[model samples]
Target chain A: MALRRTCLAAAVLLALPAVPAAALPPGDAQRGQAIYERCQACHSLARNRSGPRHCGLLGREAASVAGFSYSRALRESGIVWTAASLDRFLANPFKAVPGTRMGYAGVKDPQERADLIAFLAAAGPCPE
Target chain B: MRDTITSLPRRSFLTAGARSTLSAGAVLLLAGCGGNKAAMAAAPEDDINILNAALGAEQEAIAAYQLGAESGLLTKPVLDLAVQFQGHHKEHAEVLAKTVRDLGGAAVEPLARYDFPSGDLKSEADVLRFAAGLEKGAVSAYLGAVPLFAERELAKAAASILGDEAMHWAVLRGALGENPVPVAFVS
Candidate 1:
């Protein structure tokens, strides 16, 4: 009877949406770390290296990344870089910004994109 | 259905039917050779499609090159640029053919006859106009295919090649005393 009750409780939780860690896999934070290397070319996690210092990029306004020459189209357009928006843009930059200079065609795999997103989420928002 | 006919063995009947079927198969195989020969003579199917588009672009370029070569509109320096442009197109076809082969695909041979613009051949201006149109079409075709390719490397390679085509357009347009970028952005 106790086991049955436990199974029933698990099922109910699984059926719900917007559970913080429920939908996400226990992603290898290490793999996510490695994948961030590729992104480092155009983005910087420590300090603004090539384009923008992406340390606390999450929850930040897309237009406000400092010292980067963002396309005028992107700067004027009010798109914020939340987890969802970042994933969509990483899938295809051209689709996200039709005429912007980010020429990457995007990583196609969902899990990889997810892992990368998770890494960015962990990176936290940039220091004000 | 006579009982006397049933006395003959099933084995003989099966053997006779098999022999007749085999003969019929052999006859059909011989008749199908014409298409097979043509297939052998021409390129493999996949490469043919890629090159058919490529060949059309190269032919247009050749026409423009010849015009640029013959016209006295430009000095030696500009004429040299025209020659280099023509050479690249010729080499592009060769390299693309090799790429198809490296990927285990066949390369297409050019067709015997092609119909190009016959309306005007009188002046340098007419030739430049034709060249510009050809370059525009080639750029369009290359850029159009970039999104269609699914493979990661192939998509990047297509984009890289498309960039060259764009440069060619810019160069040719400049040669004709037109702006390299008449329009600001290409989406």
Candidate 2:
């Protein structure tokens, strides 16, 4: 009876979707640099344009950039940039923050998103 | 002498003697006044022009939403959402027109008919895409206009409208099963 119960539990576990050991896939920063070209239309490493500068993106709070106008939704959103957070945001930004001013369609490819995240992570740390 | 000065008709007196000289002097006087007026009006004139352009775009948005609402391609929540967005555009148009009037400019009227891609709007998805495209264009246009306004208040108002347009664009993209906010910034 115990053996049958264990087998049932194992089967149920197997039936569930596989959870990845890591939230993000292995990314190539080099490839991500190329992907970052699309972001250049609004963002820059040094100065704010249509969007805020991205030099210190990782570990930064959303809408924290000085002097850049941000949407009320993003300004109120208590999001801190992290690998997992960025992965989700890069996948579907509007879903993550409903009224955010970002008009992008999101990167659907997990690998590409991972690569992009990696590139941003490597861009630099948050300013002191 | 006083009787003669008072009895002479003003127009006849000016025209009877030295007509060419009087005409030239009058022209110069008018020209001087006109140039000064133009200089003083230049800033507001620019704001009015920008406001009129914004009004025209808002009118276009209202019409586009009307088209989507009547297309039979949308149903339920989507139709309702389209109507709501149309209301927003109407409000935008009203504000823009009023601002133009306040600035002493004639607000531009909407085109009798817009040249939307009617051939492409065959399905609900197509309609959504069309609306999304317009919203995106509106966002970009407002972004460009925000900095051009001489009135800081007008620039702020435009930025506020731009935010609304960006939200609409995101919602339309969401309806299309696309990532609504794919980018970290609106370019």
Candidate 3:
């Protein structure tokens, strides 16, 4: 019980507002910029439009968006987005983080995913 | 909640009144001790009932995958994936059972035989479709329980499980010639 309590506390603290991080190969900012349009519906770099803001996604912990009422699952998931992790997650959001609430289906094409990841990675730190 | 399991086929293996006595003992212990009220509320009859129901559903899911694997309908890649999915269900089952125990509640035990209502497994498509249906059911069950857990932390656990169930549902749906990520939000 003590161990469980400590773990839960750690999870809660990690879920608090933090930075974002990701890893990806050098990508075509122009192509990635175009591909990123698909994610505009729910995600915006400036605000929590529909999903959490992607302003400073790189170097941040998963589900750490302050003031956003994230699904309990996403908040509790011990994940930090990186190129590799985000690649797997973006390929299948439900698979990467089963309880996450990012409603987008995911970019199936490898090139498309890479381009998008690159753009998001370089998008810079978010401030919502 | 043990009472609810009476109708479940797996309960037959246990001696009659065993669950009843177990529940009764747990209740007495809880009633006598000055336990945490919030915890007790978190494990209320309805919540435990939902947990048991989820447990039963997951148990059924594991069985379905096992049965599918044994049917010899899948090839190399398909067979490997089927086993991987089965492992997922097993993990879900373990977490669920541990949650039940943590809540000081009774859980459904694995039975010798589970009668999957979905009829005969004739072809590969039939097996995939059957497994898909079960995953869908899991999504439904866990999603429904997310709001029912009185304890906030338990709700988080339920939500986590619910997400995985939704993934399974979506992935399996895609395997059957359907768009994998068909929807954004799955209720």
Q: Which candidate has the top score in lDDT?
A: 2
Model 1, B75-143: lDDT tens digits are 677678778778767756555555445445555455343334445645565666656666665665555
Highest-TM-score candidate: 2
lDDT of candidate 3 over A56-115, digit per residue (tens): 887788789886656555666666877766676776554455434453345656667778
Worst 10 residues of 2 chain B by lDDT: B26-35
The DockQ of predicted model 3 stands at 0.02
DockQ of predictions, in order shown = 0.01, 0.02, 0.02
- Candidate 3 chain A: worst-modelled 10 consecutive residues by lDDT: A15-24
**Model 3 error, position B96 (Å):** 1.5
lDDT of 2 at B58: 82
Q: How do the residues B13-120 of candidate 3 rate in per-residue lDDT, one tens digit apiece?
A: 344443333333333333333233566564365455556656766776787788989888887777787888787667666766765675567777765665453457
Candidate 1 structure quality by residue, lDDT tens digits, A6-119: 554344233323324343444455577756655532244655422456777777776586555565545644557766667666666545654344434465665676787778
User: Model 2 over residues A1-128: C-alpha lDDT tens digits?
Assistant: 66654554354334323434286789999999867755643455665544678888989987899877676656666667778767767766555655455645467688888898889989896456
